[model samples]
Target chain A: MKLVAVTSCPTGIAHTYMAAEALSEAAKAAGHELEVETQGSAGLDRLDPATIAAADAVIFAADVEVRERDRFDGKPTVVAKVKDGINRPAELIERAVAAAAEAPAASTPAAAVPAAGVSPATKAEEGASWAGRLRGWLMTGVSYMIPFVAAGGILIALAFLIGGPEIASKVNGGTFDGHTYKGVSDLTLILNQFGVAGVMFKIGATSFSMLVPILAGFIAYAMADRPGLVPGVVAGLLASAVGAGFLGGLIGGLLAGAIVLQLVRLDVPRAIAGVMPVVIIPLVSTLVVGFVMLVVVGKPIASATNGMTGWLNGLGDSNKILLGLIVGAMMAFDLGGPVNKVAYTFGLASLSAGNLNIMAAVMAAGMTPPIALALATVVRPKLFNDAERKAGEAAWLLGASFITEGAIPFAAADPVRVIPSMMAGSAVTGALSMAFDATSRAPHGGIWVVGLIGHPLLYLVAILAGIGVSAASVVALKSRRILVPSGDAVAAAAPSSRGVVAA
Target chain B: MSQIITPDLVDLDLPGTDRVAATRALAERLVAAGRVTDLDGFLADVAAREAQMPTGLEGGIGIPHARSAHVSEPSLAFGRCAAGVDFGAEDGPAHLVFLIAAPDGEGAEHMKILASLARRLIHASFKDGLNQAADPAAAATFITQEIAA
Candidate 1:
């Protein structure tokens, strides 16, 4: 017997390929010639029209909607879940073969056979996988969030550039001449007002703020496959409502995903499959996740966030330097991963609450690593390879403009040494800025872009000092040769294409 | 079944021909080989079906086919080209061509054959082997062995 099959999963990942492999192996064992095509993240592969022409039967093992079904107008096709392809591939194949064999000889003309559109239930079931649904939601949400982060960060930068010291005194609770303070204070007020433009902005920002939860929700959806989306969204919303924030959202997503997987095993009718994703799973999972967030998870996280904020506000005098060091290290440690984002978020929240010094320390530490690393590669060329030297030139511009991603290539190439070195440099800069009572009215931008920094000259001095130390340390520590040789260098060093190298 | 398989039905440069041209060329070959009675009717059948939707299969392959009133019997033409031709695929370029010809009233056998071929072509090694076969005889031998297994 000969058979043809198509395999696909919602997330476009593991299960699709696994099912294809299982079916191929089973057919081979059964003395049947089998050909299986996988629809994955990278797209389709290995398609031959001749094989399709000769197959005795067709099988579709999928969680997502399969396109181009009209091509199989006359063939008997067995549509089953990818799981069936994995656990009972031979059985599925045999059934398809039997059906094809038993069908009456076509009395009707082939050209007259009607093309079949996919059933609505099948369409719904195809998209029911939690991952597919959540991803659709997250893609929508992330598209909305980018504007908030950019606008908020830039407006704050502009306020400082125009108003400067007088506004700083007002936010710090120092009494300036009311008239002078009012001039600066008015601009801050105007900027703050845009933070809530209208009901639409409010809703959009609220959705955007739930970004992490959305990511978690989609990941869970991917795992549980269909019937996971509803629960995942419910869990995400619950996490948001209860202040479990992103962590709660992650838990909710996972919980929803697991529950849906269990539900799918019940072998419900194909008609109900579509409804399970949009209505049933969400309703059940939301109730469970929401209850947990409200009763068990919400209070502790809210209290912890408050307690941390209070401690941060009270950090003064003798403890100021220590606080700065910690904040600085946290900001640079992950370079924009969760820990770094958390530190940056804290600084922005503090700015909203009128605490400018913490933001100052953050800005100082955030800009140090890239600037220092860029300087290091320039001052000591032998410490890096040719690629690093070229990358250093670009990093210099990004570093000077205060884009922390400037150091990413270096860190990615050698995280062990580069990351630790950056953390140390940033921490020292932050601690020193705090100790010197450095202040910034704005959130970010490099030292040379003084409009964004308070006490611009002092900030420049501190930045330069940090860069000097980091560059010297890198020169001392980094090896005198490139770690990974350049492609050109490797080619040049090769004996010859015609000659083989002895092991 | 007075079907005929001709040399033109098995070409070396088909992987590079335009899909419409290739299909016409295939139909012409079948007509010349006396596999089908009316060439114009066969071409019309294929064009009408193609107008509804393309038959470009996934995995860098395509099956451009038509069942026509002109066709006297069901027949297949296999073509291979050193340089793959563009068949307006969603992912771009198609290298393998299988032009299927059947009587307008033929049964499910045509669909079954197309499905079987589509499934086997998913194996990268098999497609590569077929593409590299030295001649039409070698290609036919390989296909026979694959189906018989």
Candidate 2:
């Protein structure tokens, strides 16, 4: 069905564009032809009168009065908040289609007003920005979750430093050293070595537990603001409760936030406006997201995590090198991105499973990108920009400290060149680390935790080898001056094309 | 010829978590920039606009805007808070805040700048550009470039 939408927010600013983008995208995705008119601060980009006449249904997704509502008086109509344009485009389209079906087209040819508006030249070019926007939205959540990952991972590593690897394995809760703990909880904790280390381990694990929920909560916050938080958080906890991991958290966060954004778009009566934010929005979003997550999304991701666990365990001794290579590639693929986190989390999972090689590879590869980029900049300073040179200086400390995100500036600047090189280097390090049977009990603290690593010297050697490879590759790429489109470099960290990345 | 957002108007380390204080801080920058004739009077106008409805947008942003006689020119002041300040957003606090002060009367420059800004805000890259600015100068430059001034 053909649909026409008018999107306007109270401020007639950002929300207007966001809603227009959402509705058009959703409509297109659902196989419906859609056009949107944005009455924003930029003035009206009116829908063509001919186009509106052809539209079978009209969606008035406006917070303020539609400038030309009288034009669509006779058409099948769906009145909604502008928020829904972005968050509930498909639903709105469905309603419009249904409304069109219900209202007989030939029954009443209402007196036609004169064709008043021209076709807009501002039909936003969506192109590659769609993927970039989704990435931005997801990263919004991940960015917030990182502090939890760092502090929690380090604390757990610290616990290992003090109490040894047994604490983590013990806390993982299963058959261990003949003592079997049935579950993982405060109540289930069996502290045979109830020392300072054990207490630290518990504290660290507790902090780590909040990552998914925080990730989910903030993602919602990004998508829909204050109303999105309540639902996003609840759904995140649910994701964990159902064993869906960060993937589930990502989906649930998106779902909860979108639902809340859509709900807020509802034009509630003045009498109920007070209760809308506090009671109605949260209640409705939570209920809808809860049902969707538990029933629809929860199962698939649960199986995925469970399957990944089994696959990692099944890798055993024979496929250790292969496992290392795979995880290493993942670590460098985005350098602390979703793929990297998946590998890191996988390694963390294996730690509790009493397998340490995965963790060893994870660390080696995670440290490779920054160190390699830093090395590249130093080896061939002319190849790098001034900013790259500066970042290189800081990369040394960040890489040594095991902060993978230090390479973000470099990777973001020249992703096509930087990422593959880093991945290749990390993969080599990972495979070599596994080949040498390197293992780590600690989750973080790069050079500082060398004492905690099994075969420390070999591990360092593996990191060095990866660093050399990456530096060589990046420097070589730079020297060739095979310049990527300047636009792509900025696309690494954000939407280089503004007013449209989100649009 | 004068830019709407200047280096001095960009505060990288805006302190505290109170929106009122944050607004006042940004307003003070405008006063210092000589864009506003009166501080209290301008803030009062901003507060009144905010009272009608908050200027906060999703994705960690708060835009407190107003048209006032106290504002001598159309000016924008950017402030970022590491420790976010509550802007009455449902999600929590706002980390990035843009204070837009427009001169009273019939000038459309402020509206045009605002519309350009509103359009730009929808893009994550623009926000990222603002976020990653090393200093106020870099931020001011970026805003000018993106707003195409």
Q: Pick the candidate with the highest DockQ.
A: 2
- Candidate 1 per-residue lDDT over residues A259-283, each given as its tens digit: 6666545556879867765676667
Model 2's chain A TM-score stands at 0.50
**Listing candidates in order, what is each one's chain A TM-score?**
0.45, 0.50
Tens digits of per-residue lDDT for model 2 on A277-345? 778988999999988878887677556656765665577667888989988987888665456767888
Candidate 1 reaches a DockQ of: 0.04
Candidate 2 runs further than 4 Å off: A1-143, A157-196, A267-274, A306-320, A327-426, A437-455, A467-503, B1-149
* Tens digits of per-residue lDDT for model 2, B57-106: 66787878877889877789999999987776656688999888877765
User: How many residue pairs clash per model?
Assistant: 29, 2
Give RMSD to native, each candidate. Answer: 17.9, 22.2
Tens digits of lDDT, candidate 1, B1-149: 32223344677676366777777776777888887788777777777766654655445666666656676665777777556656555666667776767565525444344334434545566678778877776776676455434
lDDT of 2 at A253: 90
- TM-scores, each model vs. reference: 0.40, 0.42
